[model samples]
Target: MNATTVLRAVGGLLALSLSQQLAAQEVPPSLAELSLEALSNTKVTSVSKRSELLTDAAASVYVITSEAIRRSGYATLPEALRLAPNLQVARVDARNYAITARGFNSAFENKLLVLIDGRSVYTPLFSGVFWDAQDVILEDIERVEVISGPGGTLWGANAVNGVINIITKAAGATQGVLAAASVNGDQRVGTIRFGGRIGKGRFRAYTKTLTLDDLQRESGAVSLTGMQRSQVGARADWERPDGASTLQGDAYTGALHQQGTADIKIAGANLLARHTVRISGGTELSAQAYWDFTERNQPNAFIEHLNTVEAQAQAATLLGASHRLVVGAGYRHAFDRLQNGVGFGFLPAKLDMHWGNIFVQNEFDLTPEVRLIGGAKLEHNNYTGWEFLPTLRLAWNPTASSLLWSAASRTVRAPSRIDRDFYSPSNPPLVGGERRYNIAGGPNFQSEVAVVAELGYRLNLLSDFTYSATAFYSIYDRLRTLEPNQAGAGSVFLNRASGRTKGVEMWADWRVTPALRMSAGAVAQQVRTRLDPDSRDASGTTGLATGDPSSYWKLRTAYDIALGHSIDLLVRHYGKLTRPAVPAYTTADVNYLWRIYPNLELSLSGTNLFEARHAEYGGAPNRTLSGRAVGMKLLWQPK
Candidate 1:
C-alpha cells in the first residue's frame, strides 16, 4: 500500500530520573512523585555488578524506567534506547538497527554487548545481535540500565564498547491483567499480560505480536521489508525469609519479506532459573542457569539451528567492614548447525563450542569519602584461548552531592565463526584453471583487544538539578584484516589493524516543577585507524571504524498534567556518517498520553517529524529511509 493509502486506514501513535540519596519517609508518596523519589533512590545493578546509587556509578550510565516507556509509547527495545542519548542508534531498515557506543557503528558491530536479564543476546555465529529476534514485551520491562564504556571485567568479551542490561519487573509487581495495542502507517502491535498468585509464588504470562508493512522506498514504492512476529513468555517468583527464586521463559516465531516472498522464517525459545540467598554478615549469593534453542530457514539462502546452555554463580561479602569482594564463574556450550548456500556456509556444518569464565571484583574503602574498585575476568573459548580483562576505578565524594571518578579497563572482542572457515566462490574458474579463487578461514586468527581510560564528574547543581560529564579514550590492537596466503593464492582473516577513539558525553536533568522535567545530552567522538606497518597484507585494510557518527546532541521535555497523563517531546541531531556518506539529519519525536479512565489510557505519538524521510546508514539491499510517522495506542488494565 502507498503512504496515503496506509495513513487513511489508521493513525497512530504514541525519561528517567536518577536520584542520589533517598531518605526514608514517614507517609507514603503519590504515584506522580514516585519516579522522582526513585530517581534519587534507584540503585543500579549493571555498573559495578552490585546494587549502588545511580549517582555513585563510576561509569557513564543511564536508566529508562517502565513509566517512561509507557509515556513515550515505545513499542520496541531499540526505540526505547533512544531515550539514552549517549548511544549511537541508527535505523538500517524497518526492523534493523546499527547501535554502538562512542564510535564504530556497523551492521554487525561486535564491540557492544546486550543482555536480557542475564542472557547474552549477541550471537556466536557472527558476534552481533539479530535485532529482529531480540524481542520482549515492552510493558513488562522494569528498567534498562546502560553503561557507555568498557564493562569487560564485570561482563565479558564483546563488551569492549558498552553494555546494556534489560531488567524486567518482578512477577509480584504485575499482579493484574494489562493489555495494549497500537497502529500506525507502517505497523500494528498488541500485547497482553496477566499475573496473579500461583501456589506460594507469584506468576505472570505475556503475549505480544507485531505486523509490519514494507518500508517506503525512496521511489515511493514499498520495499521488501514487511515482517510479522508473535511472542509469548511467563515467569514465576517465590520468596521466603532467607531466599528468593525465579523462573522464566519465552518462545517466539517470525517471518520477513524477501524477494517478493516472506520466506525468511525464525523461531526460538529459552528458559532460565535464578536463586538468591541472603546470607548473614552482609553477604549475598546468587546462582542462575538457562537453556536456549533457535532455528532459522530461508529457502535457497541458508538454514541454521543452534542450542545453547549455560550456568553461573556469584557471591558478594564484606571484608572487615572496609572492603567488599564479589566473585563469579560461568560455563556455556553451544551446539551450532547450519546448511550453507553457494556463497554462505560454516566450514564445519555442525560443531560444538565451549566457553568458560571467572571474575572477581573488590571495592576498598580508602577512607570515609574515597573508594577504590578493582576487578579482573579470565575467559576461555574455543575460538580464542585465555582472554584476560581487568579494570580499576577510583571515586571520591567531596560532598554529599558531588562525585569525582576515574577508571581504566581492558576488553576484547573474540573471533567468531564467520571469521574462520568462511568460504565463498569468487566467480567461475578460468576455463582450464583449477578453481582460480579461494577465500578461506585462517587457523591462527587472534582476538581483538582494547584498552580504555575514562574520567567523569557528577553533581547536583541544585536540589532539583543534576548534571554529569564523562571523557574517555580507547586504544585498539590486533583488529581484523584480510591477509593474503602463501604465493598470493587467497586470503584469510588476520589481526593487523590498530586504531584509537576519544569521546566525551554530557547531560543534565532539571525538574522545573512537580509536573515538568527537562533533560539534554551531547556526545562527540573522533576515530583514527591505520594498518600495521611491516605486514604482508592487502592494501587499505578495513579498519575497526565503520559508519560511525562523530557528533550527537538531544533534548527531551516531559510534562505531566495528571496521574497518568503526559506530553513528551524529543529533538535530536547526528553528525554526518562516513564511508558511504549518509548525510547528517535532525528529527523530533512527540508523544501525548491521557488516562481516560482509572485503568485505561490513550496515546498519540509521532516520530521523524522534520522531513518525509531521512537516511542514517547505507548499502543494505532493502534499505529505506523511515518516513515521518504518527500513531495512537490504547492500554487497558483491571483496577
Candidate 2:
C-alpha cells in the first residue's frame, strides 16, 4: 500500500475510536497503568550504561515495556522486537529469525549485539545470534531496550550497528504464582511460574514449553518441518540497605524436524550472578559473571559443543561537581568443539578463543542545560588482536520537555570462525587433477569497521504526546567479501568491500484519551556499497550483507473498552525489496482482552489478518510463507 492509503486507514481508525469513546460513560483508566508520561520517564540503561529517563537519553533508543508485551500477545522474543521501529525482524523458518538495525540485515548479521541481563548471546562461530536458541519467559521480562546506533564504545566489539538489551524483572516484584497458556492452529505454548520468599530474599522458578507446526512454501508445499522446545529456569534476589545480589539460571532442549533428513537437536544451559554495592563518595560498584553452554547437532550439517565464561565489573561515581565517570573491564573465554560434517566445517575442529576489554566513559556537565559525553574501549580478540572503539556525544536540553543530541562513533565487527577458519568440503578431493575446495577462510581476514554520526531530537507536549526522531549516516571499510584465489583453488573470505548507510527512525505516542492511546513508528534507510579497486570479489558480497526494505511504517492503538476490557490494533506496511524482488505488503493484527476476575484474564489475538499467507524473507519456492494465525490465551495470577 502507498503512504496515502496508510494515512487514510490510520485516520479512519482514530476517528472511529474517538467517536466511540465520546459516547461511552466508563471511568478513566487507572493511574497505576502505563501512561504516555510514564513511558517518557521510563528508566533505560542501554544508552549510557547508567539508568536515565528514556527521553533524556541521547541515543536513538526505544523501550518495549511489559505492558506492551502483554497486550500484543506475542509469544516469541523476535515477534516482540517488531515493536521497535528501528529494527528489521524477519522470520526465516519455524525457528530461525533474522533481526538487525539500520541496514545490513541477514540471517548471519554480525554488527548487531544482543544481551540478556548483561550477558552476551552471540556465538563465536559467526559473531551472530541463533535466534531459535535464545529464549526467555516473556512474562518475566521487565523491558527490552533497543538502541539503533553504534554502542561499541561501552559494549565492546560486534556492536557496530546497534544493541538490544533484554532486562527482566526482579524476583521480589513477582511475588505470587502465575500461569499462562496459548494455542493456535500452528503453535502452542504453556508456562507456569511461582515466586516466594527465601530468608530475606525473593525467589522465583518457572518452566515453559512450546510446539510449532510445519510451514508451507509459496507453492503450498511443506518447506520446513515443525519444532519444539522445553525450558526451566529460576531466579533469586537479595537486597540490603547498601547492596543487592541476584542469581539466575536456565536450561533448555529442543529439536527441529527436517524433510528427508535427521532432526536437528539443540540443548543449552546458562548460569549468571550479579552484585551491586553503593560505596563511599556516592560511588556504585557492580560485578557480573556468567557461564553458558550450548550444543547443536544437525545431521549431515555440523555438530557443535560450545562453552563460554565471562566476567565483568564496573564502577560509577562523580569525580567532581561537573563530571560523572564510569570505568569498567571485562574478560570472556570460549571453548568451541566442532565435529565436521561432510559438506563443510571449521578447520581444526576444536579451538579456544579469548576476548578482553576495558572501557571508560565520562559525562561532563558543561552547563545546567548542556552535557558532553566521551568514552572509549580497547578490546582484544583472538582473530583481530586489538581494536579501538570510541564515541563522543553532545546533548542540549533547551527546555524541560525538549532535547537535542548529536553523536559520532567508531565501531568494528571482529573476525569470527566463519571468516578465519571455515572450509568447504571437510575433505577436499581431486577435481580436474587438482585438489580444490569451493570456499576457504582467509587467514588475513580483518575486522570490519564503521564510523557513524547521528543526530536526534525528542519532544514532549504536556502528558499526552511524545515524539522522537533520529537520523544516522555511517561510513564502512574493510567489509567482508569472497575473493577467488590466484591458484584457482577456490574463493576465500577477505576484506575487500566498503559501503555507506544512511537512515532515519521516528516514533511518536499520543494519548487520545485517558482510556485510549495511539503510537506510530517508521523507518527509512538506504545502503550503498562498492568493491575496493585492487580487490576482485566475484561473489557479489557487497549486496550479501544487506537485504532490507527502503521504508516501513506501523500504527498501533490501545483502547480500554470498559473497566475490565481492552482491545489493541496494529497496522504495518513494508516496502518492496529490490535485490530479492519481494513484493510490498501491508498487514494488520488485533488483540482483545477480558479480565474475568481480579487475578484472571483471557485474551484473543489474530495476526496477519489482512492476508492468507505472505513471505517476509528469502526468495522463490524455497522460502516459507507465514499464514494467518489466531490464538487464545489464559493468564492467571494469584495475589
Candidate 3:
C-alpha cells in the first residue's frame, strides 16, 4: 500500500487505542502510582526498527528512559548502558570503550551496531564505533533501546550481535532553558538546552561540553593525558492535526581535542529528517533521510575524512485481524578520504548500497491464550545481490501477567567499506620492521549470515516483582575474518567457513515497597569459529583464534530507596583466551543519585569501582585500570 493508505489505517488505530485507554482511565481507581510508572508506557522504536510496546515484544529488550537517566545520575551514554546486563560496556581509557553484546570483547568490536536517533555511527575506517565521537546531552535523551541479539533483518549490516538505538525527545519535549553540570576528580561536563514552539511546530536546541583527565596507569601514578570536547545539537518537530502527520528534523555537530599518548583531533556532524503519516485503520508510513560527516587528524601526520548519506521509506498495514505487513527500501552512499603517513598508498573509495524488502508477520490470537508469528524479509543489497530472512515465533500467555515465547529467525550482515576496503595502522610493531603495517579489504567478500533460535519466558510473579529469561543459539556462516598477507605488508579480509554463537540473558525488577525498588540482570555467551584449513593471514596466525572468545559474562544491579535516592552496581567479565593475547578480568562500577527535590537532583558516581587494573583481551599493551573518580551533578527544571 502507499503512504496515504498506511496513514489512514494508523489514524483509525490510534483513535481506537487512545479512546480505549481514556475510557479505562475515566473511573480512576484509588490505587498506587509511582513517578517511574507514569511514563513506562512510552513507545520504543529500536526493537525492530519500528514502534512497539516494552511488554509485547518477543525479543529481549530494555529501555533506559530520561527519568531513569535522571535517576541513575549518569554523565554519558556509555554510563547508562552499564545498567543493562545484555551489554558489555567497558572503558579502555579516558576516551576509548570496549562495548559488545554476548562476547567478542575488543577495542574494535565489530559485532555490535550503535545509532544516535536513526543515524548509524559505526565507522568505515574500522568496523567498530569510535565511542568518544558519540556525544549528546544525556538529559535530552528520550530513551535508549537495547536489543541483545542479531537485528540484521531490520538494521542490516554489523548488527550481528546487538543493536543500540539512542532516541532523543522531540523538540516539543523541552520548552525551557534546562541546564546541568557535573564535576569530578578528573572529569567535568555540562549541558544546556532550550526548546519552544514556533507557530505549529516545536523546536529544541542544546549544547554540551566535557573535559576529562587521563586515567592513571596500572602503576597508581597520576597520568597527564586528558581530553576536551564541545558539541551543539538541535531538533524540531511539527504535527499537522488535519491529516495526522508529523515532521521531524535534527542536526548535531561536535569537535574533540585530546592530548593523549597519541595526540588526536576530530570533528563530526549529522543531519537527519523524518516524516510519519498515520493511515485510516491501523496502518502507517514513514520516510527518513540523513547525512553524516567526520574528519580526523592525528599528531603523527595521519588524516581521514568520511561522508555518508542515507534515505529510507517504509509502509505498514494490517492484512486482517491477525496479520501485519511492512515493506521498505533504503539506500546508502559512503565516501572515504584517507591520508596515511605509513607506506600504504593513499586510497579513496566510494561505496553505494541499496536494499528493498517486505515483511509479513502474523499475530494470530489463537484460542485467546496462544499466538503465532511468522515473518520474512526479502532483501537485496549491492554487495549481496539478494538475501532472504525468515522468522517464526510462538507466544503462550497462560496467565494475564505472564508470557512464554519461542522464536527462530534467519538474519544477514552485509559487507561494508570497513570489511571490503579498509587500510590502517596495527599496533604490534613488525617483528623485523620499525613500524608495523596493517591494511584489510576484500573485493570478493560475501555477506555473513546466521540462523538464530531463541526461547524466552517473562512473568509478573507479583505486583512487586517481574522477571524475564531468554536463551539463544546462533549458527553463523561466511563470517568476516582478517588474515595477514604473505607479502607481509597488510591483512587479507575474507568470510569464515562456519561458526556458532550461543548465550543466555536474564533480568528482573522488584519493588520491595512503594518507595523501594531493585533491579538485576545478567548475560553469558560462548562463541566458536570453525575456520577453513587454508585460512591464514600474513602473520600466519589463524583469524578464528584471535577473534571473539568462547565465553563472556555481564551483570548489573541497582537499588532505589524510598527517600528519593538510589545506588547501582555493574560488573562485566570476559573469559580467558589464548589466541587474542591478554588475560580475563572483571570490571565493576558504582553510582548513586539523590533526588533533592521534585525539580532539583544531585548525584555522585564512580566507575571501575573494582579498579581491575588490567587490559582488554584484544591486542594492545595499554594497562587499563578502572577509572576511580567521584563526581557530583546538579539539575534544575523550572515549572
Best by TM-score: 2
What is the lDDT for 488 in model 2? 67
lDDT of 2: 0.88
lDDT of 3 by residue, 1-639 (tens): 999999999878865765564554432211112433333345777654457666667777777766567655678777788767677765666667878876656777777889987888888556688887787788788888888877766777567778899887777778888889998666789888888887788888878888877766555654444677788878778876423333343333334444343657778878888888877887788888888888877655567778888888887777777666666777777776766655342333334445555544455666577877776666676666878777788888879778888888887777766666555652335567543447656677888777889999877654667777899998888866677665566677787467777878888776666545566776667777667777763342334334544455555555654345577665667655555555777766666765544455668877556553565533444444554566788887654
TM-score ranking, high to low: 2, 1, 3
For model 2, give the 10-residue run with minimal summed lDDT: 24-33
TM values, all candidates: 0.92, 0.94, 0.83
User: Which run of 10 residues does model 3 get worst, by summed lDDT?
Assistant: 27-36
lDDT of 3: 0.68
lDDT of 1 by residue, 1-639 (tens): 999877755533110110111122121222235445357567899987778888888889988888778778778888899988789899877887889888878878788999999898888877889898888888788999989999999888999899989999889989899999998668799999999999999999999999888786655667676789999999999988888999999999999887654469999999999999988897889999999998988766678899999999999888887899999999999999988776656777888988899999999999999999999999999987899999999999999888999999999998888787566552425645554336766668888899999999998764477888999999999888877765446677788888899989999888778778888999989988778894566634454274577899999988877555689998999988776577899999898987655566788999899988888776433357888999999998866
User: Positional deviation of 450 in candidate 3, in angstroms?
Assistant: 2.1
Which one is best on lDDT?
A: 2
Model 1 TM-score (2 dp): 0.92
Q: Tens digit of lDDT per residue, candidate 2, span 1-639? A: 999999999979866765565455343343224567777889998888877799889999998888888888888889889888788887777777879998888778888999999999999899999887888888889999999999999999999989999999999988899999998668899999999999999999999998988899887789766889999999999999898999999999999888889889999999999999998787889999999999999999899999999999999998988888999999999999999998999997999999999999999999999999999999999887989999999999999999999999999999999999899987899888875879988999999999999999999888899999999999999999899976668889999999999988999988888888899999999988889997888775677555588899999998888776799888888887765556788998888987655567788999989999888887776888878989999999865
